[model samples]
Structures are given as C-alpha cells and as structure tokens.
Target: MVVLKMKTISLKVNGITKEITVEDNELLLNVLREKLGITSVKAACWRGECGLCTVLLDGIPVKSCMTLAVETDGKEVITAEGLYSDERAKKLMESFVKHGAMQCGFCTPAFVVTSHYVLTKNPEVDGEELKKELNGVICRCGTYYQIYEAVKDAEKYYKKETKS
Candidate 1:
C-alpha cells in the first residue's frame, strides 16, 4: 500500500507569511479562504470566467480558482484585503462608491484586483483601454458602465497623485 501525504508549503499572502499543508489537488482560492481564513477572495463561478476569485500573483492579476496551491510556494499573493489601505485602492473604492460601480459586491474584489493591475501598469489608460482590460471580468450585477467609469476615474486620481 502507498500513502500520499499533503505537501507543506510557505507563501506570503497579503504581506503575511504563512505555512500550510495542502492536498495536491487543492486550489489556491480554497487555501486562501479556508486555510488562511482570508474571505475577501470570493469564490463565485469556480470556472475562471467570473473573475470573482481574482488575486494578485506578484502584482499580476490571476484567477485564484484556477491557480494551484503549490504553485504559489515562495511567491507573493495579494488579496483584496491587502488593498483596503492602499491609496490607489482607496481611490478605486471611493470612485466605485461615488459612481455606483458596485451593486451586489460579489465581483468588486476581482475588479479591484484587476483594476490595481491596470492602473498601476498604465495610469494614462483611456476609457476604451480600461474597458478592454476589464473585459475578462464578468459582473453579474450589471454594473459594467459604472465600473468602467470608476476605473477611469481612479486612473485620473492616481495620475494626479503621482505628479504632485
């Protein structure tokens, strides 16, 4: 008889270092929410389409549901919780709130994570480019228009902040 043991790995999630033992088949999203107790990364469409499980893997947006737990070993994973205090994130949240970009709140985390990637990568992005970048994320609450507007406004906010 052969026995398989779960692998223990270390990862820095949301700026915190954690060591966890996970099964080979475990997804990063599950580990994050269940094991690490970080519920900000919501699990919606388990399939990579919802974008609700989005997270920052070394500053690039990735679908946590499709990512393997072991693959995050020794890497940095930033969740929506980590962005709560970030200036850019603050601006995004403010814009979203003021522009009515968030409705049900299920998809906001993904949009925030994805927007972080977009705005940080290019603060000068126009509405068309912002919409194109956010194409992969599906918001079931029908807040696409307001979401796009929020991203555009966030870009302008960040640009002004950086210049001064």
Candidate 2:
C-alpha cells in the first residue's frame, strides 16, 4: 500500500498564522485555497503559467501553484486580502476602481498583490518597469491599460508614505 506522509506546517496567510497538517507532497496553492480558505489565490492554470495563484512568500511574489506546501513551512504569505489594511494598498484599490481596471475581476487579486509588492519595493517604478513587473499576471479582459493607469495613480500614495 502507498502511504502519503502528513506533516505539520506553520504558515501565516493574510496576517493570520495557521498551523495545519498537510500531505508531504501537497501544493501550496491547494493548502492556501483549500485548507486555509483563502480564495484570492486563484486556481486557473494549476501549472503556474497563469500566475493567478501568486502570493507573497516572505515578502516576495511567488506562484503558489508551483510551490510545495512543505516549502512554505515557517513562511509568511500575503495575499490581496492581507493588504487591505495598508494605506498604500487602499489607495491602489481605489485607483483600480476609479480606472475600471478590474474587468471580469478574475485576475484582480493576483494583480493587486503583485502591484502592492511593486509599489512597496519601488514606488517610483516607471511605465516600462511596471509593465514588466506585472507581465506575470494576465488579464483576459484586456484591461492592461486601465491597470497600468491605476498603478501609476496609486504611486503617489506610496511615495508619500515613503517620505514619511
């Protein structure tokens, strides 16, 4: 008989620390969406090509679909929902809404999380760099321009925060 080893892992999702048991070979995407009930980490292309399952692992964006649950042990993951309390993220969200960047809304969460990371890392990122940084997540509705504008609009908030 084949046996799957179950292991306990402690991971923080959306600012909440959770210690849960999972199979040794379980994927982080599954653990986050299924076990932890974090639906923002979409499951479009399970192969990680879509980047919809992206999450900030230890403050760096990574495809949860491509990561193993065991690897996330003792790691901190931040999703779009986790950034809700941040002033910059709030501005970003507002900008997205104002610019109508969330058509269809399927990829919004991932884009938000990545965009938040980019703004946090480099609030002064230019258009080309922002485009490159956001290339990982695809918006099927072709709302790229709006998304770009939204991110740019929110840049000032991050810059202000940085100066403070």
Best by TM-score: 2
lDDT of 1 at 144: 95
Q: How accurate locally, in lDDT, is each candidate?
A: 0.88, 0.92
Alpha-carbon deviation at 81 in model 2, angstroms: 1.0
Task: Give the clashing pairs for model 1.
Answer: none
Question: How well is each residue in 72-154 modelled by candidate 1, as lDDT tens digits?
Answer: 88999998889887887888888988899987988888898899889988899877888899987898889999998888878
TM-score of each: 0.93, 0.96
What is candidate 2's lDDT per residue for 9-108, written digit by digit as tens? 9988888889989998899999888888889889998887889999999999999999999999999999988999888898899999999997689999
Q: Candidate 1: list runs displaced more than 4 Å.
A: 1-3, 161-164
What is the overall TM-score of model 1 with all chains considered together? Answer: 0.93
The alpha-carbon lDDT assigned to residue 161 of candidate 1 equals 68
